[model samples]
Target: MNAREVNTLNIVGGRVIDPTTDADGRLVDIHVVDGRIAVIVEAGGALPSADSVLDASNAVVSPGFVDLHTHLREPGREESETIETGSRAAALGGFTAVVAMPNTDPAQDSRAVVEFVREQGRRAGLCEVVPSGCITVGRAGEQLVPYAELMKSGVTLFTDDGNGVQDPLLMRRAFEYSSDLGVTMAQHCEVSRLTAGAVMHEGSCCSHLGLPGWPSIAEELMVHRDIELVRITGGRLHVLHVSTARSVEMIRAAKADGLSVTAEVTPHHFTLDDESLRSFDPVFKVNPPLRTMADIEALKAGLRDGTIDAIATDHAPHADHLKEQPLDTAPPGMLGLETAFALSVGELGMDLRSVLACLSWNPARIAGIADRHGRPVAVGEPANLAVLDPGVGWTVDRRRLASKSRNTPYEGRSVTGRVRHTVLNGRAVVIDQVAQR
Candidate 1:
């Protein structure tokens, strides 16, 4: 496909909810030509004959979502996920782009690896896959990678996701070095010393189950340290997968103080609690383990009040048998890309616009991908949009997911809201809840 070519597509009779253009709740028809929004008229308005038409009555037409964090496990771990499968899952979740994490086998520290990942995403053609750089060499936590080099290679976000930068001094220097690079330092936010052998959140749940606890303090300590570091270094910091009450409060306070700090919370953190661990399902296991109901409420409040900027999926995928291992032995992650929209809508208790903002626009700005993604639904803009049914309810089936792995914790859970059609670059990658590819 050429850069300026797309099938003539028309999305008819849908409520357009674009916060950027003050078009929320307006019934509009979107026309796409050559991959750009050619016109938006009232529902049933006449227009040029389109080869493709999607009846979106009672649905929502909004900017396609952008996930700030996603593990596309390629270049080494294709057994878990590749850019193509992950992009398919993302498209089904209404995401037009996902920032690919740097925790792969070789770790995306070099420009060669970074370009390869970006090129693979291009080949997939499902969604935009933006590669992130490692904060440290090979994400080893001891030495810093070349930020200028990575930035020139088009990576604006950097992180050591599976492992937080354990050394405070090293983290401080990372922020300092980022001062001139115009990159954001994203932290996984676990103090390694505090979470050495932990499996679940520290609380009565762990005590009752006789399991090692991953305490909230381990996350809060790093949150506090990174905030102070940003305060001093005047560099931007993005806290990834924040899961604790105190961590939320500290991030709220840091933002109030006018620091350039942003944060994201995973759907699993807000939708499930540590009590799920009582069932001994390794699928519930995650790096930032699920916390108490109190923490879930706090996270919901954070999203409601804008303390947390984006609702990232953390979209970690593991092989079937890997997640089927005993809790203590299994890898800590769960499939998220396909279930995030349903979980967020049914659980957040917020209005449609705010919820979509957290899922789309907010994360787009954070990931620095607002130019091509998360833009308003209007004429002359790229037609990257998600047609959503906010009131539809469905149950998740792990076997039917587009992801290469089947480790979703939301399996069998009933949820509302679904991505009906996902139009990426003006072509329907997902139509009627199915990936066209």
Candidate 2:
């Protein structure tokens, strides 16, 4: 992977979409030298010396995607996922970086957990895996985790993701500390009081299935509370995996008020609905469980008109044993890394740049990895990119996914668009819909 030994590798005949530079996804040729973009010349234009070349003739080349939330399941639950497996899945999903959630075995509330996850990602050498810190001691949601200590260890976002901080005063104090430390506080946005023992979204669909429902208020109430807290503390608040219509309206109004607030919606939220849960498939089970189609439309609208800041995968993975239990008793989650891009393009129906903004640049800025990972395709930039065939249509075969967990609801479902190639640091980790390494 050394650059000096390999002088240059040219990526030609691709549509370059560098939103930062107004590339606008036009067809061009990109030359990589010493692991950096040497030049982006016109198609068939003069190119630098090269030992290799990637044919991206039918692909759309854009900055690599950054997942604002990914559960790598390392240090605690390797049976479900590891840094290596998750990163490979991410690469296949057109992601260059992922923020590993802190709710691991030892819980990334301490520096030991934080450093171990970062080192593991480095050792795996698959994708940039940034570790998040817990907002409470041991993620117990009781006492706050040492935010200052975690920040010192390179942690950027703090959350007890599996559970929201139930104590309003404690959450308020967390925001106060977050403002001083300059790290973002991301909330899972569910009121435990309302969601206790609930299996799916509370709605007509849930009533018909006779399943206990997780009311929209469970999520919206917390979102509403957090937005008000952000206004008071002036701390950066990022709402994670928002799943309800009212939640979107709350975030939209907060933005309208010019608050320092940002939010992300999972692909499932915008694409699927609670109706999927009627099958009793645990794969459809998730926190902030899938809402009704009306909610789905609102989520899509939020993404379409820019009210939503990013499209986070919330790529939670679970072991088969965990997910095999009855739908009501099973742990909530599903595989996402390998399906985010296609799902977005197929369901959202927006231009490529807007989609990439949610998948790439916008999330990078939120995760604080913008400088190296989300840059445009041009001279003097790192060769981190995804080449996708925007018009390709395909069905998701869960068995073919790179993740150890196969809990995706999209199995056997036809979807449009596909990631043809993914280049990370000048190497084609994925080429022609296949992972190289």
Candidate 3:
């Protein structure tokens, strides 16, 4: 072994599932050195000498997951979360990189803010934090931000995530500009006109609760608008946290039409319904509120059939005081970074390879980090990997979360999959199911 990796840790005897090569999970031993994969030997192969050896027998090792959408809430709202704490939560959840949402103090519209977010993430060194620039300055939806300058700052995606660009003309202009800059534009997919004063999904649940209603049409109409915009402008459009059945159908049709479009669904959307709000817990209150059981089934089908591209944790963290507010008044978000993978594995019911593809490979490609991450477990690839114990079931503990906020709806909920270890850039960031500082 080279000096850089002679004493480094080696992971062996795990079922490696790398979707890039269509390699179904198989028993293998992987040696990592100098922040890259040095060798991937079959089970019972000759052992390589290293400073430390991790016995991952009976576990599943795969590429670290990539989250295309994450709200770290740093810079402006450190009370909610910071880069360090958020990265810790992401590492525990088996993610190596999380695309930071731009809805921060002053917003991530200008080149300066984008650079600040990237620098903060680098300072933490916990996970690769990519910042997404806002499509409109301050996300007011009035004017477009400097897309080229932001992209030059290494921003691969743009979005006014908390709010969609309301003006059709402005959105079309954004698509045209995004196409030129080669950065993807992700949409929140809500029509303010229809969703104004809305609290939850406009369904039997909302009516029974006597709450303000957010209609499926509000989300569906904007989804349709953006799909058509993608067709006209020939730019990449990514629908974020899609919740409704009709919206899925719209995206399915758009894909059939050959538009460069992609979509992601949150864990709560498929696992929980609007009825969770019957108890009046604000933790279950989310922006694109939960929908009907039929919608849930359709979303699962979309994911299983490859109609959906990635399973991004729209991991929005809100402070306790904020989440404790009245359901209608409280901000709509929940802690997700630490719980996404377990929820995905338990709810998706797919093979290990398929689940990793949705969580790791597909999102890595979408976020433009696939070159360094999401590679097959082979020699010469970057050593960004996660080992998971699939049979170990555990309950969610909100108090132990690394993130500053603990607004998780899944608190105390039983989950099957747990992250055993995470190796990032040849460093054991997480070892033996614990975060290594």
Clashing pairs in 2: none
Q: Give the Å error, residue 254, model 2.
A: 0.7
lDDT of 2 by residue, 182-282 (tens): 88999998889888789999989989998988999888888998999999998889999989888899999999999988889999989889888868889
- Deviation from truth (RMSD, Å), model 2: 1.5
Q: Is candidate 1 or candidate 2 better by TM-score?
A: 1
**Highest TM-score against the true fold, candidate:** 1
Which runs of model 3 end up more than 4 angstroms from their true locations? 1-7, 21-23
Clashing pairs in 3: none
- 270-330 per-residue lDDT for model 1 (tens digits): 9999999888989899999999999999999999999999999999999988887878889
1 or 3, which is superior by lDDT? 1
Clashing pairs in 1: none
Error of 3 at 25 (Å): 1.7
Candidate 2's TM-score reads 0.97
Give Cα-based local distance difference scores for all models. 0.92, 0.88, 0.88
Give the per-residue lDDT digits (tens) of candidate 3, residues 107-190.
999988888999999888878999999999999999989888887888888899989888999999999977977789999999
